[model samples]
Target: MPRAEFDKPVKVLIVASPYYKDISDNQIAGAVAELDAVGAGHDIVHVPGALEIPTAIGIAERLSNFDGYVALGCVIRGETTHYDTVCNDSSRALQLLGLQGLCIGNGILTVENYAQAAVRADPKDQNKGGGAAAAALHLIALTRKWGNSGQSVGFASDILLAGGKTTA
Candidate 1:
């Protein structure tokens, strides 16, 4: 993982879900505190549940000034299969957004029981929210590096750079 660029000013948006209000709130707080420590500017947004985080992040990506996004939510399994759908779909959605060059911090917790969820929600334990924020910040740094190096434009050691012509 790359170090946090504490010297640079970065803007982050955190979206928390209210489904598992207790756990989600804890995660969001963890994210906020961690980002604050890194000297980054941030905003907190609330949504209905895990399902809504991806869309909120999508909107954030369209902003020209926002540097990154953090999605925090907790989904505890129940007797029904609803948990699987929410967890899987939300994870894939956020991953897709990130792959498209959207800096996303995914903190969605999908666990089989309350105990499992509690472990992650605890500030001292996994604290996945904090981890996610760090990841987003790191990715932002990498994006800046790649953008500056011009490596993101094209391959350097390839014949394609010859304007579709080969030396005779």
Candidate 2:
């Protein structure tokens, strides 16, 4: 993935659901690696399940000084509809938070089985957790480019370049 360059120092919060211990651990590892690469400070918060990640992030956003957030978890499809509810509700809440101006990178895996989650969660393979962290970093860079209001006010859009450089 392309890199997001920060003009200012950043701190990130990682809200993770470790329902699947091994899978969630790998995801967290990938997310941490990405944050470390960008020299961002990060801390992990464990929740009971995927459903709680968004709420944890929301609370952090309100009370903490994090510049960005990475959400990591796994929701594998089982014999019941519980999987769908967990997947949809968690995702929708995260999206709502994003729409409200939070820089969140969602890494929740909604897979059909353990195998799929394993493949995607593996930092050496799909590295989805890393990808999600990158997404949040990009948004952070973009947010800084436009200033804290997060609404582009100029008549013309700024052509963003690497490392948060932009030309109007």
The candidate scoring highest on TM-score is 2
RMSD in Å for all candidates: 3.6, 8.6
Worst 10 residues of 1 by lDDT: 152-161
Model 1 lDDT tens row, 1-168:
544874569999998897777887778777877888788899888999898999988877776468899889888888998989999999999999988998888888888998998889877788888888888888888887777775634444545434686432
- Any residue pairs clashing in model 1, and if so which? none
Which ten contiguous residues of candidate 2 have the minimum total lDDT? Answer: 148-157
Per-candidate TM-score against the hidden true structure: 0.85, 0.87
Regions of model 2 farther than 4 Å from truth: 148-168
- The candidate that wins on lDDT is 2
TM-score of 1: 0.85
| C-alpha local distance difference test of each model | 0.84, 0.92
Stretches of model 1 off by over 4 angstroms after superposition: 150-168
